[model samples]
Target: MNKNGNIGVTSENIFPIIKKFLYSDHEIFLRELVSNAVDATQKLKTLASVGEFKGDLGDLTVHVKFDENTITISDRGIGMTAEEIDKYINQIAFSGAEEFVEKYKNDAAAIIGHFGLGFYSSFMVSKKVEIVTKSYKDAPAVKWSCDGTPTYTLEETEKADRGTDIILYIDDENKDFLNQQKIQELLTKYCRFLPVPIAFGKKQEWKDGKYVDTDEDNIINDTTPAWVRKPSELKDEDYIKFYHELYPMADDPLFWIHLNVDYPFHLTGILYFPRIKSNIDLHRNKIQLYCNQVFVTDSVEGIVPEFLTLLHGVIDSPDIPLNV
Candidate 1:
């Protein structure tokens, strides 16, 4: 029961295994990390609604900051405790982080969170990873630091906020994460309409000779995405408008289905079947998956029924797995 220590697994080739396989696209690591943060935040909202924990629900935003050295993802969510970290991060056998990586190194997307190994994928592009977090409870903030290895160190830290900040020291090979344009593109691709607002940088406007910072933040996501709202509350134009937002270059959608079911399983979303041109593979993964409006995955085949994969639209279901 080691907290923030070597991931208690017998596998020694786990790191190399994950780097070699698991995901089809290296860029997907960003999506998995961000989606996890969104899920954590949404879980807090669900808990608060049930009157589980009475606390001030401050601005729930996911901030993605990148510099020459690192890429950081910070969120004001229900931060994990020491024990929770041990259960989620240190233990991999129960979750399947190692097996999936070993099985599917050639196909990147296959290396996804098949076994709750989403967080470990950071090692693929990062030499070192740090988690500075403070739980919603009265517990002190803690800093968990780890190199690209199984071992880690967790100790107390000075943080006034009750949330988590994950910093990934971009590896020399994966310097693309440091590029502002690349980061922004990934955000728009994977998290255009996340439940929480995601801010990458400051707003810019044309000034005297060049662009200058505005008081506004460059918020990347639509806090209240079209899929999160009720179909009854929205008009046909609204769905069409959001469709354009997702595919500005394409024509209008053919038809759509507003899914909202809260019984055996909780689900809510709007699936649109866009007109196809040539091959169906071109539009295979157009349907984006979201957990409580937080963008999870665009390549959603396992979560949605097989027939729905060819459609083009947004599906924001809190019950769906982000790694699926």
Candidate 2:
């Protein structure tokens, strides 16, 4: 696994797979990487819940940082060993997410990755990618790297941590990702309500002449959004507050419904009845859909009833399918 070799592929080379996924939307790379990081952190929590892991789950926050040439996403989750890296990262057929779900079927939480392509999606916007990880089981840290090719390198590395760090070298064409404004917008759109707190940068405030960074971290998402909690635990003001968060300019909701169903399939959300001011067409697609708190789509034409789309609020379910 340490030597350079072509990535595991049955038919076509790795280049085609990158191109195939790239055509849909390269910005999706951010979502895939973030979701995978959340999944890893969740799996660690699940393991701890089942009494298999007793160590401290200290600071499980997923941190995303970017500079002119690189975007780094670091997670304090259950990292991979040398062999696990070879099997999961190097071997596409193994499908790490699917295997983990099946292996921990009785105890694991809902994972995001279905196909093994989530991690590889980085190649869509990157000329090179490197993974630095150390397992929670007292294994040595290892670094795995690959250019925009089939060949990859793996070797031992020094890392004073027990998680994974994914470093993506922004390609010349995808330099837009290097901009903090653009990255912040993408993070807000896709991960505003993720279960884990994502620290992108520092809170900013106007000082003498210009904006300056504060000591506090700028956490993007709300870990305990109202929708994820029980309706009984939330008050009327809570729903209204969440509604304003969703649509700031809109007036307060006339009424709301807390939908909670678990018998057939898991589902939980809040729907707000808003005052109809604009034309009916303007509110056609106000309902936002989520799967496991990750924003999936707003166009729920094929998934839900037509009339439901006119309402405002969120509809989340782990049963919903994800892109990668």
Candidate 3:
């Protein structure tokens, strides 16, 4: 057999390829945007820790807000200037995340982005997208707007904050994302255990007659899941509690194992032996997989033994090379 050196790509348009192939699920746009926001927030924290930025780190929550026709993801992270937008956004696939990670490899703990292609995933569900951002350094804020095409516009804009806001105008085909309940559901599924607190809408309370929005923000994640914590610091009850948090109606697990490994590759997680029923297939997808607390998938067929995958719990490792 004559082995070839490598295959070559012919298509120059990356957006269409991302639209038709990169990710199968259109809902993945939410995970990608939120992960980027977390990365930005994390990068700022790193800068502040190293005395690069002396400003007070305000509330770093990534907020997801939507009106009838648009959804805006706001983060109080290291924002970008016009020049950065030109480098990161306009010059598609030039990864800012990769560069940041390399520079701060020792200082940074966990960063969730690898491919710069994440931003364009917005176009899968959006007719138009806008990025309003201001760098943490003394600089003017700018707005970058683009439709579904390759062309874009970047101009000086007024923004009081020193972070970024990604606004997406919902397309007619993907109008279901504009719904509040739908967004909350997706956030819960993808960002339930992220490192940063994410606010979606507001907590509801039973008022005089019906339910009303409370002053509290509906924070969607637990920054410190039990898996990420030291097992020595936890009790038997803590494991049970976390298991129920993952499976609300299920009974107490028969046994549980707390995993904390850092040899070949860093890994941390907890596995619970749930009360197995005759229908084994039902339990196959119970084990959730993550990369640096960002939910990757519930399917872990390749990562673990076929039988062990039936156990319920979580496994997170930044080193896991996922195809997605």
**Evaluated with lDDT, which candidate comes out highest?**
2
TM-score of each: 0.83, 0.90, 0.87
lDDT of each: 0.78, 0.83, 0.80
Native RMSD of candidate 2 (Å): 5.9
lDDT of 1 by residue, 1-324 (tens): 224467776666677666666434678778778877887888889889999868988888788988899999999998977767667777787335455554555556644655677888888898899988888877777788878777888887888887899999988899967999999998987777776678889999998999988878799888787777877889989999988887787778888898788888887878887877879546643887776565666766667688877888776655665555
TM-score comparison, 1 vs 2, better candidate:
2
- Cα lDDT for residue 89, model 3? 79
Per-residue alpha-carbon lDDT of candidate 3 for residues 216-271, written as tens digits (9 for 90 to 100) = 99999999999988888999999999999988878789999999899998989999
In model 3, what are the clashing residue pairs, if there are any? none
Give the TM-score (vs. native) of candidate 1.
Answer: 0.83
lDDT preference between candidates 2 and 3, better one: 2
